[model samples]
Target chain A: MRLPPILVYVLRRLAIGLVVLFGISAVAFSMAYLLPSDPVTSRYPDITNEQRAEMRRQMGLDQPLVVQYARYMESVFRGEFGRSFGTGNSVVQDLAQRIPATLELASFGIAFGVLVGIPLGLVAAVRRGKPTDHLVRVVNIAIQSVPAFWLGVVLIFLLYFQWRLVPSPIGRLSPMFISPPPVTGFLTIDALLAGKPDIAFAALRQLMLPALVLGLGVVSPLARITRSAMGESLGEDYVTFGRALGLRPRQVVLGDAFRGALVPIVTTLGFVVANVLAGAAIVETVFAWPGIGRYAVTAITTSDMAPVSTCILLIASSVAVTNLIVDLSYALIDPRIRHEYAR
Target chain B: MGEKLFEIQNLSIDTRRGGVTRRIVENMNLAVERGQIYGLVGESGSGKSISMMASVGLAAPGLLVRSGEVGFGGRRLPASDQKGLRGNLSHGVSLLFQNAKGALSPFLTTGRQVERVLAQRKVPKPARPKEITELFRLVGLNFADLGEKYPHQISGGQAQRVAMACAMASNPALLIADEPTTALDVTTERELLRFLTRICRERDMAIVLIAHNLSLVSEYCSGLSIMHAGQVVEEGALRSIFATPLHPYTKGLIAAVPDVDEPHELVPLEGSVWGGRNDIVRCRFSHRCPHVRARCEAGLPPAIARGGHQVHCVLYEGEAA
Candidate 1:
């Protein structure tokens, strides 16, 4: 039996995504190899040539560039990211241990941005020239221009130091609390599974300020895109037709207009997700949170080639996968494209 | 003719931009009885579509009904009462626009689109499918072949028929068709107009047909309103308006229409539409009127009654019936 067209399309995308990821990893590996500060020199500034050669050989650096890259690819295939020069732990294992905290932050940040951005955008578009629209526009522009690190610091100062409204911004958990058992590699979900409401609440409270800052960073672009998309959709003939059919104003705005506006909004959301992840890396540093972002930052600062390459490779693959999902959603969001895909 | 089903009296519409308001459609009086096709004819920006839209409470954004009273089913409709108008829409008022393909959602199939209207009309769950099929059939579409196709998949004319089917889903009493055939070829235009007239007859439905082409209006309309520069120039029974072209603007419009039997040089109207901000109280078409007089600019000409017809021109003020 013939498989469905959508399945075939998704499979083709997956194959392309893999090849792109492979290309990205290759570029990342080469870039990391070319860095002036390698593990040997950074670890021992006054090291002799004999000691340097031995360290290089152990890390497979003495081999040819192609051989090193092939070995790196082989190790990556075996779910190993080599080892961090400082800690001597598998980079993959280090990332796996810390990913839950980052995932927890970025997910909440993006969800907050979208959940709040869409409604604010709809209001702005629906009342295009009104005071509310002007206010939302000004606020969004402010958010868009403000850097993530500055916003995170400001939020921490205002909410923590000045207002004393929030708990200290140290890491994912409070000093009094212990982390919940891991399940599905998401801290919040793991906490809920571990059935420790107090621990979960504490983790969430610790996440709030950094996530809000990161989320605020993305909200502006999402809201701007949504506003324009909805404004255009609202001007469409079908929206007027819906109104003429005597459907309620709510129905016309939300049902007909929103559905038409969704394609562009979905496309924006995919990019927003990727941007939030990148923003989280900076946010994680500001808050001193133990996530892959800080882990990668430490590796880069110490000239650890393997961990840095692995981090770049991971980020690029995740972004590529997000874009694939976005491309697939276009078919689902619009029947015209879906029909074209079938053809 | 059936009793009057709807009327718009002294309708005035305006557009507000940057704290400035300007009148676009002024003192528009129109009446359409059940089963009658009332043609509102004018050039673009004459506010023909705006007037009809305001009548049905679907004015485009930024255009406001400054003053008007819409009467439907023997109840007076205040211009400000939009919620009441929306409520009355299901008491059967529907609209069809010129761009039929654009009027249907591209995201939904044609059949599903029709079903959306039916669902809005509150048709019972079990009966909606049957009703959708029946409506598609009524509008001359085969549900099996064309129903599942998106608006872009079908031909323009077919898409229009789908729009017509969606309009019929509500079984409306007053159908406001705004240049419904402007996008179609000559043959499709005629077929669609004929289909519209047939529906008007079969359902005893009153239709406000807003169009620019004089020939199409003359062919299909029983009653006609000729508009110029946002004001009514002449109006009455179509035969009487055609016979006695009193307004100079009306005469120029008729003269511009190409007549195969009496072929002559097509006289395009001399001047473009009046759009400047001046002479708030004067006749708008005075600049374009062939028989313009000093009195024409002093004030707008009042409608002069003559044998079941009315013409807004100073020349016709004292003419004998």
Candidate 2:
């Protein structure tokens, strides 16, 4: 039986994605191996040379590089990422616990970016030469220029200390409330599932500052892409033709031009999400949010190869998946692309 | 001539760049009677498109409509009030562009595009599909075959027809076709123009066929205004203007068309439309006119009328006197 062309296209993309994921894992493993500090020495600095050699042998690090890589890949295929010296827990367990926090933060950040950025961009494109366009451009540039961590610190100072508007920049939940049982792993969702609105709201409130800091970083690129794309779409002959047909200005701008602009905006959104996932390390550390980004950072500093490589593979896979979704979505938004793929 | 359907009087447009304002279109006037196919012939950058677009309140954002009045559907609206003109006049007018495919929304199927116009014209939802099919058939397209396809899925000729279907959906009284056939081959161009003329006669619709090719205008238009730079160098009924070519620029334009029966050396127009200075209030064609004289620089010459033909040139000034 023949598969449909779209299904074939998706399968091909998935196969390529798998190969890329494998390549990324290999690279991450090699790069970790090349690190100057040995994981054994870094963890137990006072150990004798013989003890170090024995530990390396036990960990399979004494084997040839290819053999070690083969063994690592085998364990990875079995869903085993070994143990993280930094946390004294299995790498998979550590990631499972912390991935939720990162995902929660990143999702909120992306939501903030899309909600605020797309409208601002459309406004800028519509009022291209006016003061509003200029103001949006200026504000986007300002937000993009400030470092995410520094912005997080400043926001914490203002909203937490000076104004007392939000709770302390501690972890995901206040000390008064224990975290809900992990259902989907998102604290807010898990809390709500566990029938605790107050805990869910507290989780959300704790999410705001870090998410905003990460989101502010995301806004500029999304808005700038949206502005240019929408601007180009607005200038298309269809817009003038639509106006000439007596379509309402709102219909012409939002219905026609915005839809035309969505392809690029969505493509940019994928890139933004991938970037946020990877770049959330600084903000996560600042906010004391237990996400994979902070975990990766901690692993890197302590020369814990297992968690570091796992985090790299996780981030790389997310980016690959995002790109795949973006490519697939192009077919959904544009019939031209769909036709091309169908053929 | 039949009753006037649309008119543009004293329409001028300016563009400001780097703190300098330059007039791109000057004191243009046009009148199209019902069921007439009028031609606005000019080279690129001669403001043929700008003037018509400005009259309909569709001019580019940077272009300033300095002064004008557009008399359309029996209402004389100030050309500067673009918002008012657009809102009031759009239902009575529709535009067809050179690149029909580009002028179509790529995301919408061809039928949906036409249906959108029908909806905007307040055709009830249940009736839109039939109306769309009727329009598609009217434009020489099969709705079932082509309606479901997007712009890129069809050929150039089909896209143009789809655009035509969209234009006809509003039942516009005046169709401003801005180089509608520029992107098509010769056979398709003739077919489209013939279809346009047939539609005009059948519906009593007026069409302003804007083109750079004088031959195309000569073949189809009843009356025409010849634009050079920003000004109309000549305006007259087509037969009379072609018979007794008065303006030097118009004569040159006619001479430049290669006749297949009697081959002659093509006398191509000498300077481009952009060679003139915007600061001088003289005949804009003076820089390119073969018959340019010192008197040509005095200012824009007054229109010297003969029968229904008008020529703005110093050569005609003496003859009129």
Candidate 3:
């Protein structure tokens, strides 16, 4: 038996989507390569001839350019994401250690953003001229324009310096005691499992500035988009159909309004993730967080192209995967847009 | 009080434009009796759709109701308050949008979508299973396997039936079909309406069938209201309106339809409906009303009722002139 037309379209799109992603990765990778500075030379000033030769052999850098490229692709396909030249550790291991933190931050930030922003946006749309709407708009504008780095710095200065409310950013954990073997690899989760409130609090304190900075930056744009989308959806013909059916305001908003709102929200997620990744690099360095972004910057400064490649792939894959998920969800959120293909 | 199942009394809609208010639909009134199909016929932007949407309190953002009292089931419609209206009207009233494909939720299965309507209205637990099966059967759909299918799996006609089934889920007192068959092919349109007529007859459902097609309503509607520029230019029994269209716009619309028996030349209405962001002292149709007189532009015309037919035109001011 054959699958449906929409399913076929979805599969075709997935195939096409993969090709498009590959092309995007190629362009981004090429640009990264073209940028000035290599990480190896910046880190190691005095390298003996033997050390240089050993490093070359270890990196497979002495091989022809085509040979190196082929090997990189081969390893990438098998999930052996090369080694970090700066720390001389497996890139996979580094990723395994850092991914959970970045993801936790990004996911939490999005959840927080959507939870807060959607309501604010709805308020802005419903009460367009009222003081509440104006205040939200003003706040959104402020949040949108302020740089995440600057915002993070200010939050730390005020919340950390004056109040001494949050725990110090001691790299995903506290300095007061020893920790377990980092099961789950998320400090908060690990802290909970170990029943150590100190570690959990430390983890939360470290997480606060990053999550706030990331979530804050996203809240404005997300809220604005959600508001406008809700407004637009509320005006759609079907919403009238809903009202004519005598649906409640809450019903109209959730069933009718929210359905229409997803198109923008899904599209916005792509931009949000891009912003988060970019911010991740800067934020990681700022907080001295031992994440991939921090490692990537260090690897780049030392011209460790292998680890840099891994980082590039990680970010690229993340963006591609997120975009794909959002695309798939479009058909789910709105029943009107029937997919030509889905698997 | 009991003559008509629904009555729109002096309905008017106002829209804000550039900080100025202008009337869109003014003092429009119509009656839809139980077991009667009332067709609302008009060209695009003639306020036909807006009138019905507004009458049911479905006016979207930016469009405000200047004045109106829509009464159904002995209670004045709470158009101004959406919260107050939901419980009373929602389960009792269902609207079929123009685009069948666009109207139904794309994500949900046809059965599930129909089930949601049943669920939201909180259909009694015992009656639900039996009712679901009966509804599917009535709409010419078999739930044996097809009910599991999504909107994409079905044809346009089937999707419409599914939508109809959804609208009929709670066994509504009124079924408001806004161009239900416009998206369907002729054969399918005919088939769907036949099914609709059958169901209405069996269920005693009052239908407010809105459409641009005058002939379509002529065939189905027992009564009809003709709208032009947000006003009911003419309204009466379908047969009466067809026999002698009181309004010039109605006359033009009837004239435009191709008749096999008459075999007459088609005369399309000359201009489009008026669209501007300005106030009007005179009649809106005056800009396009072929029977326009100098005095017709002086003030807003009243809906002159004679022998149960109302035509908002200066020519009808005299008794049966």
DockQ, each predicted model: 0.73, 0.70, 0.35
The runs of at least 3 residues in candidate 3 whose Cα sits more than 4 Å from the true structure, single-residue gaps closed, are A1-96, A122-134, A228-232, A247-252, A304-306, A327-339, B77-79, B82-88, B248-259, B262-278, B287-294, B298-308, B316-321
**Which stretch of 10 consecutive residues in model 3 chain A shows the poorest summed lDDT?**
A334-343
For residues A1-343, write the lDDT of model 3, one tens digit per residue: 9988777766777787678766765664555556676334455668877887777777676777557666767877798876776677898887887888787676667777778887889898878778999999999888888987787778777887888887666566666766655777777778889988777776777787787777886788788898899888777755665455554567767776777788887799678878788788888777777777888888777777777777877787777777877777877776455444343
Per-residue alpha-carbon lDDT of model 2 for A114-158, expressed as tens digits?
A: 889998898999999899999999999888889887888888999
Candidate 2, residue A161: lDDT: 96
Chain A TM-score (model 1): 0.96
Candidate 3 chain B has its poorest 10 consecutive residues by lDDT at: B78-87
Q: Write the per-residue lDDT of candidate 2 for residues B1-321, one digit (tens) a residue.
A: 689989999898999889888899988889999878999999998899999988888889999999999998898999998887786545778889999999998889998999888888888999988888899888899999998889998989889999998889889899999999999999999999999988888888899999999999989999999998898888979998988888888889988999888899998878788554578887877777778889888867767887578888888776743
Candidate 1 lDDT by residue in tens digits, A1-343 = 9989888988998999899999999999898878887778889889899999998888778899999999889988998888887678888778888888888888888888988899989999999989999999999888888898988888889999999988998988887987777777666677889998888888888988888888887688778988999999999999988888777788889988998999999998898888887877799999998987988888889988888999898888889889988988889888888877787
Docking model 1 quality class: medium
lDDT of 3 at B261: 85
For candidate 2, chain B by itself scores a TM value of 0.96
What are the lDDT scores of the predictions, listed in order?
A: 0.86, 0.89, 0.76
Provide the TM-score for each candidate, comma-separated: 0.95, 0.95, 0.85
i-RMS of candidate 3: 3.0
